[model samples]
Target chain A: MTSTDTTTAGKETSKPTPQMEGTTKEFYDFCQKKELRFQCCSNCKQWRHVPRLMCAECGSWEWQWLRSSGRGKVFTWTVVERPMHPDFVEDVPYAPVVIELEEGVRMVSWLSNCDPHEITRGMPVEVEFDAVSEQLTLPKFKRRNNPL
Target chain B: MSALQNEACIVGIGQTPFLRGTDDDCSSSLRVELQACEAAIKDAGLSNKDIDGILPFYGLSIAEDLAVNLGVRDLAYQATSHVGGAGPGASVANAANAVVAGLANYVIIPGGWYGYSGRRVRQIVVQDVNAMSGGKTARDFYFPFGLTAPVQWFSFIARLHMMEFGTKPEHLGAVAVAQRKHAQLNPNALLRDKPLDMAGYLASPMISDPYRMFDCSLEADGGCAFVVTTKERARDLAQTPINILGIAQGQPFPADDILTREDPFHLGVTDAAPRAFGMAGIEAKDVDFAEIYDPFTFQVIQQLEEIGFCERGSGGDFVADGGIELGGKLPVNTHGGLLSEAHVLGMNHYIEAVQQLRGNAGERQVKDAEIGIVTGFGDFGDGAIAVLGR
Candidate 1:
């Protein structure tokens, strides 16, 4: 019950986040070229994070690239001051957010461009990227605001 | 054989050196257990070659692993019981049944792993012939919600238990202090003389919402072996033979099929207590002392409530009386426990129960103890309750 928001900036971060190594030959090719893509299920016509072998709803194996808007909201999160990974030591007080996308999927992504004290459970968010290594870009999220 | 009662006894016990590290895979610890078996046989005043049966447990432990390590020239009967934490009790009951059935004159039970050897458990997976991976029922349904490890799995239960009853973290913290205090007196204990305090408990890192680093058991390398033989053989071989008066077990319903299984009160302990009570012809009050497993603080409360020791959800208050301490009415874990003592798959718990009845617990001895009960519960709702008497 002591779970609290740590991030304070609440800034809107704009950009398409990076994907972990190409999921498939074609997807990898797309990522290598810095193109955003996801499996658009032909049957359900939906995009999914954590690329799966088949469609969860229709059980359809058919899918194709469907570029996403890369926007979501914080469904839940934890502010971790301790880093389990030695690489993450510099990122202390980081908020690991479980974001629910407008497309109806949840992902655990790092929330940056904000202080840990400003984060909360249902905050509007958008994706961004942080360079982790020469060949890797970490997908991070930040508080997104809706424009009327 | 008597539907619930049997004249069974733990004739011998064995243990390995409590080390922080070790060589060899899981098999190395199994070999240590074999050496323990050799020693225990001599302690029981029996020949090591007299073992005729074997019962092991699941997890990092494998019976065949022990057989290969013990180099069993021949195995008359052998079986492995489930209920990860339930191993010591369930296996003991199974071995006792084997003895009563006249299927085995002497049975050997061993369970030990590289618990603290810094070996990665998940990475040590065996080749799955079924290639089966993933959860089942409720867990499978909730796998998407980030509940994987036992820490996370118990987190939900701990939260609800707290919400329902006014259980404080200190009440749980008391469990560590009590057990650690006992360890201070035991020469073999890893944390001897390094007991914890309230400030220390508060300073420990939180593993989950309610559980701190101290709440969990150590996953280390050690071996626990037991020799089960006929009561007649025990009398002829050993000076003090502890009698096994009763045994019982319980299992969880399928995770998906049932949400509320016979109320929270009718949980696993309900399944274990009755059969044991019937077998021993004794009530909860009859237990001179207890060696209840302490893998988690809440599980102990769960057992106390379920065993009818106290009213439902009154576990925290029941234990707050210091009843589990050395001089308390029912002193628990005189040899420390998996919490403060080393975790030898609760085999050490079994050994302590025998020691209590035999009046062999030197400094931690319970005064004039005659009858005792030891429980083992964990791993997929498996449980074993054994009543031992002098």
Candidate 2:
């Protein structure tokens, strides 16, 4: 059955806001602009996440912050049957899926707008943003309705 | 054989009482660490002046203070590994290297913490717990999306393993039941008297999907330390010397990004265990028992398979039917492990191996257990394993 809560749905605020500073600030600003972007190595053209200053492959300090296609497949996932943060109590039994983005990069985000039971390995999904706070907007995913 | 093989041995094992709650008397983390080191030194029958090298996996690099206070003049080697929980085994590996290289004679690897007492246990709150503690970039990205706590990180593995290999929740429950049985025999185990069954594990409150309360490790305050010296020297000391037959450390490619791994089911130990067995001049079959680091039940299942003890995707079946129990094919974590005994960052695994090899393990002893293996996993896919024998 589809999860009943829509706390993380829509363009609205959620429980706790993430603190943004440094490289994290740069990443969140793009989300505030409603653009999902991550680092791409200019030298090796390798996609990386948790944004790093240097490429592990080419050891190049050169990089570009490229916008994502906002599309990926679920590599693996876990439904948070018990919320770890009190702020997340309303969102109990939420699924945090690690999506393999089309650009060959992976990122952690919530899987929304579908039944938690419907989530499965290699399931196609697309990104949608929720402005959880004034300075913070989190990217979440829902099942892709149509193929690209 | 490698020059490091049989060159160094564990001379003593020491630890403070493991506690489920904070100790009013030993309140500070430093005090617990110091007392553990003191106990180790006392057990070794050596003065502080005798420790020439120190490997500290925890604390604020207090080895210098310990060396000076022990009234030591020359400190030849001092080092630490960045991998937190995965450190103890590698630390012992480093100590063995230092001893064999003549960089130091007596190397001590010390670890302990006041997790329960210090109120550092994971709570239902999303705060700066990640960035402030380790300050890694991964935390900044993952923590914001509610992927907090070690339990969540591990649940990712459990779910994937289930999806790929058809591993059931009962497969994971088997590990918890077997380890609790071992804990019952260990009077030092925090959950010693507590009993668990598959039905109880399945019904236990879910902390994270695919992980119930019994699947997770306990938050306990305790400390454990061990002394590493030359095998030749350890023979003259207080107890039977547990020789360091082989040791190795490994990391998955791009080690930190668990999501980016080529195979989600494999961890650092996949690469580490083979080299350790090779260096020990033995195979996985030669291991009489194992002291696997189990912060979660699924971890033990994964490690048992990945360590070459069984084929991949078969750890579930391997651990079934008491396969890892006291009389099973492999009697693992004979001292209850982090799952039920205490989480001393896997140092307790080493301590138990030393005890078993020395014939000092009373009720939980594996018969004729001459060779054993201990593994550590932490820092997002980094793993280490060491093989010890009498």
Candidate 3:
């Protein structure tokens, strides 16, 4: 034995168990093609975020889901040496990044594509969606053109 | 409330010495709670057993256990708010609401106990245990790595802010330095003197990433309490009475934290302060001093902008101009605050706010401060804000 405890535990989703609450089947289908989508509010003509059913601006229920530009900027990020949850133990000191897209929406995703030691404020990043499980794929981010 | 808006006030405050450890049992912590309760009662010149209701928020564990052990005679009402540290302001609001609704008069809102002093209690959080065992999160992401505490979680915020806003180590020290300087004048503070500079802060042992020992609030086993009554009774009881002007709480829109740019700098404050300000009917600039809850150093800067003390993103400059120090345009955390004084469940901020409003805060008192604002934020994105007036 190589002294490794267990490698093949046979699981689907990664830690944090990415489960969809308000996400739709259409959006899920769109994700299969590796495309990110946001909802466009009908009344205020603005894009809705976190994939909500109604418009935050006009409180309109009308929304049309469409593919995104897959681009954003780092707003704020933190190198989490401590796991907010215990399931994140395997990824011990992960970079839990907060990125603000130019389109004015903010999200929390992992930071990849650069040395965590080299990360700085306002670093530009792009979407890098990868399949973490058979039924689900997480949309994480990485530094633009800079792979560590 | 509309007719008597901005008229409610917090009249009294008190706390017990925050030690590093305690061998005390439930009844012992209850004794400390009673001590704080008595102090606030005396501070307000009221009777100890006069409280009609009890609001306990400092969950060394939870409410029922402490309430039962406290021997609170004639306890007509009881309540416990969510958001842990955010409970003080929330509890005060609960007390004020009880008074306003005539459910009972003279409610006692006491936030007590310790978060880390768990030797006697292993914290029987069945739900959290079940969730962790289900192999969903946290454990796989953090436990095996030993990222096991609240300070560690908050360190991530500081690291991210640095990566996004260029917030240097000095900015964190600037806040700590000011808080320590204030603590020097406060006899009740925990770490008086023991100065910390940017260099020293950078060298301090990392609790997690950017958070050093100094970057985090010094939490000792402490207790604090306040008494809420009608504004008229407050005037008749003490020479100086602090009134509860407003109280507010709020939550974010709930986004996929992993998929969006969640601004930790602009936190629950933005959603919370508006309600307090609206209730108080005063703009943020009019306030002479703010006794905001500072569990972490970065929280102050985030709060200042969100509370409308300055424009958004200018909180750094607001601090740069000495707006938050002693004798500045607007003093903050005058009673050493949670940073230097003690992490006494954010109820101490209410104590300081009441003291400032009543002009009784000894050497750390703000000059002629008639209005004081205090806020509390903790545990999974929750917060509460309250306004007090003389």
Provide the RMSD of all predictions against the true structure, rounded to 1 decimal. Answer: 8.9, 4.1, 6.0
Candidate 3 TM-score, true structure as reference: 0.76
Best by lDDT: 2
Off by over 4 Å in 2: A1-23, A115-117, B25-27, B59-61, B68-74, B121-135
Higher-scoring candidate on lDDT, 2 or 3: 2
TM-score winner between 1 and 3, please give it. Answer: 3
Q: Model 1, stretches more than 4 Å misplaced?
A: A1-148, B1-4, B23-28, B68-71, B118-145, B255-266
Window of ten residues with lowest summed lDDT in model 1 chain B: B125-134
**What are the per-residue Cα lDDT tens digits for candidate 2 across B170-217?**
998999999999999998999999898889889898888889989998
Candidate 3, residue B279: how far the Cα is off, in Å:
3.7
Per-prediction DockQ comes to 0.05, 0.43, 0.19
Q: Candidate 1 at residue B79, lDDT?
A: 80
The 10-residue segment with the lowest total lDDT in model 2 chain A: A1-10
Chain A TM-score relative to the true structure, per candidate: 0.72, 0.85, 0.79
Best by TM-score: 2
**Candidate 3 residue lDDT tens string, B60-118:** 43445444555456677778765566778788778878877877677878766653363
- Weakest lDDT window of 10 consecutive positions for candidate 2 chain B: B124-133
Please state the error at residue B347 of candidate 3 in Å.
0.7
B1-390 in candidate 1: lDDT tens per residue? Answer: 463264667887777776667665554455667766776677777765577787865654456666665666567778866566777788778888888788888887777767676443322311111111222321222221222244434443554566578777877777777778788877767778687986798688876556777876656567777788668777787647777788888865422112222243344557888888888888989888888787776777777777878887777777665767888755777777877778777888877787778788888888899888888876434577888887
What is the number of residue pairs that collide in model 2?
3
